[model samples]
Target: MPSMTVRNVPDEVHRAIRVRAAQHGRSVEAEMRHILESAVRPEGRIKLGSLLAEIGRKIRLTDEEIAIFKSVRDTTPARAACFE
Candidate 1:
């Protein structure tokens, strides 16, 4: 495989990438590879909105019910804790 070097990265962006790599228990190179994979890969994964829409479709919820479900999802404990 061919390799390429990315030059002239801003200091803050490099620092942020390093911090994220540490948080994910990955080497900086591995973390950058993961980021690139997510950006370039074509595999389908369940995103939150699409997952919720699928659930709504299965349940055949009314518009109001879907709105309420979205509200509850938005205010979920995990989401709230992430903000704090």
Candidate 2:
């Protein structure tokens, strides 16, 4: 696992994190990790596949219509890239 060092946190902010950590029964480091995770990967985030499916539903695409793409799609193997 990777580690991080957060520098120059304000005294009040550090104190607040300590208090919050204690309240949540977690170490200050764990609390910081939780905070960072929540800030970045939020609960209500919309994924690409889900968004595309929602659009298809809104547009009322039938199963047979979607299946037509599979029938027409190329099944060729992709060529690998050469660095040389």
Candidate 3:
């Protein structure tokens, strides 16, 4: 395993990290390692719009219900996708 050192952290930050470490039942060193690992990890999250669109296709709505939904959707303009 490799080694690392962090220096000159503020008192407030150090206190907060200590508190958080205690809350998670971990040593400060272990908590810091976990935080660093998580920062580098890729997040696996689907875009809300794409997820909603997929669900929309699977379910059928009445014309009036769709009209109401469309009216709500119109409030938020969709952003242009990079590929288009």
Q: Which candidate's lDDT is highest?
A: 2
Q: Which stretches of candidate 2 lie over 4 Å from their true place?
A: 46-84
Error at 18, model 3, angstroms: 0.2
Root-mean-square deviation of each candidate, in angstroms? 13.9, 5.5, 11.4
Comparing 1 and 2 by TM-score, which wins?
A: 2
What lDDT tens digits, residue by residue, belong to model 3 across residues 1-84? 999999999999999999999999999999999999889877985689998777877786567877888787656768888985
lDDT of 2 by residue, 1-84 (tens): 999898999999999999999999999999999999999996789899899889989999999988997799899999999999
| TM-scores, one per candidate | 0.50, 0.53, 0.52
- Model 1 is weakest, by summed lDDT over 10 consecutive residues, at 75-84
Clashing pairs in 3: none
lDDT of each: 0.87, 0.94, 0.88
lDDT of 1 at 52: 75
lDDT of each residue in 1-84, candidate 1, tens digit only = 767799999999999999999999999999999999899887776689789789879989998986786687655456345654
> Where does candidate 3 stray beyond 4 Å?
45-84
As a whole number from 0 to 100, the lDDT of residue 7 in candidate 2 is 94
Which lDDT value does model 1 have at 44?
A: 79
Q: After superposition, how far is residue 62 of candidate 2 from its true place, in Å?
A: 28
Extract clashing residue pairs from model 1.
Answer: none
The reply for model 1, stretches above 4 Å from the true place, is: 43-84
